[model samples]
Target: MYEFRELAKDVYAFLQPPLVWYSNAGVIVGDKDVIVVDSLANAAMTKNLLSEIRRVTDKPIRFLINTHSHADHVYTNHLFPEATVITTHSGREQTKANLELQGEHSASYAKFFPEFDFSGGRYTVQDMCFRGTFSLYQGAREVRVIELGAGHSESDVVVYLPSEKIAFCGDVFLKGMPPLPLEGHVSQTIAHYKLLESFEAEVYVPGHGEAGTLAHVRVQREQLERQFERARECFQKGMSYDEALRAFAGDVIPLEFQRVVILASYCEFTGRHPETKDPASQSHMSLIQSVADELRVLLGTKEVDKKVAMSR
Candidate 1:
């Protein structure tokens, strides 16, 4: 489930639940036109987002700004025919490439996301590709889309409103959860956090989870620094990636992500990219067992589900 929340007078955040692979977006309504920060994962969610925007105001959507090239954010770009899609040059290229790859292997996704319907999904890359920073105005309101390179992905951008003091930070800053910086370096993630803090924005709409303040950003940054330091110590001790992952003990939300992050950090420390071994080449039974084990830990059993339901 998702909620359309107003962060300020005319600024809104399309916040999704804290489920893995779910993303959040933003809406900036101006005098004549509107700007959508990012799109949703599937056709249904994107259509729902469009309906929410129409409910707010009848202003035409002029721009769909993609914060990164991840399929969860850019997969539904084709739905907004009236809007011009925007992202960084690298973001556009990677989006195009990844979309092609996804199309080639569309069947594999169902094994993971059974809820999302990806059938008949059309891929749409950004129309306008900028290098560093691009600013646009909807009548008098200025929206700044700046590319903070190679953090969570090859190209990460933030949509900022100076007057409103609100920023739509993409996956680089996840509220109350760990960021998957698998495609980027830990050092870059730290620098990006510092840059985000410098904005001094009163409201921050993250790529996932709820909308929060600067304090959330600071907390995430501090957590990442501490995790990286621990990973570094493990690396220095000549521990393998798998050993390091098991060594970093915590009961964090989405503990599986912490395992992957530890793998990425250890790989970087060893001066190599995280190995992308094809599961298809491995033993199918073992692979299935491994996935089941991770899922069991992540989603929990019936008792945990009942507890969550009762809390809700």
Candidate 2:
């Protein structure tokens, strides 16, 4: 399920149910055309989004700005055939690489979720790619798409409406969900939050969860700070990745997500990727996989779907 919110005059948000892979999107209606913030996870969801968009205005979608290269956000890019898709150069490259791994991802996800299907889905990369800030005017409204280095992903960007003080911050800010430092570092994610707060937007639409104010941004920031501090302290004590995970094992955050953040923080401080030749990092990655498998055994489809339904 999803909720459509009219954030401001001509500015709208499509908030998806809070769960893994589900993402929020936005629509900006211009005088003659329209612009979309990000695409949803799959084909069905994107179709629903398009239907809601048509209900508001039948103007041609001039541009579709992607916030990052995550599968959930970019999988349905092909849906908007006429619109020019925009994303960071790194994002486009990542999307191309990720496309190759879709089969593996689908197979793995199928083991845990048989109903979540990706068959018959088409993927798309950005038509226009840039390194830094890209600004365009939608009639008179200034829509600024700013790439905030790396945060939730290597291609993280925030779509800000300067005149209206509304920002569509991608995975950089998740209101109810824990921010996954999936392909990025904790330090950078924390830094990006500070920069987002500096925007002082009256309304901030996160990549997931409902649109909120700066206060929501701050709360999420504080959680990141706490997790980072704990992880750092464990690292300073020369604790192994497993030891560090055990240290924060009692955290209220879901173990599946908390472990990833812990591993990410560990990698950030050590300056190494799990896929690197480093033995320690490889072991950390193995631990993450073990925990994931354990989680799958514990929470079956019914429990996971129940959680998703409750999130709505």
- Backbone clash pairs for candidate 2 read none
Q: Across residues 240-306, which tens digit of lDDT does each residue of candidate 1 receive?
A: 6666656765645344556545655765776674443534113322333343345445556564345
| The best candidate in terms of lDDT | 2
Write the residue-wise lDDT of candidate 2 on 31-148 in tens digits. Answer: 9999998886677788778998999999999899989987778878889988999999999998888778877766655654454555435457789999889798977789998998
Steric collisions counted per model: 0, 0
> In candidate 1, how many clashes are counted?
0
- lDDT for 285 in candidate 1 is 26
| TM-score of each prediction | 0.86, 0.87
Best by TM-score: 2
* Residue clash pairs of candidate 1: none
Q: After superposition, how far is residue 86 of candidate 2 from its true place, in Å?
A: 0.6
Locate the minimum summed-lDDT window of 10 residues in model 1: 280-289
* Root-mean-square deviation per candidate: 4.4, 3.9
What TM-score, to 2 decimals, does candidate 1 have? 0.86
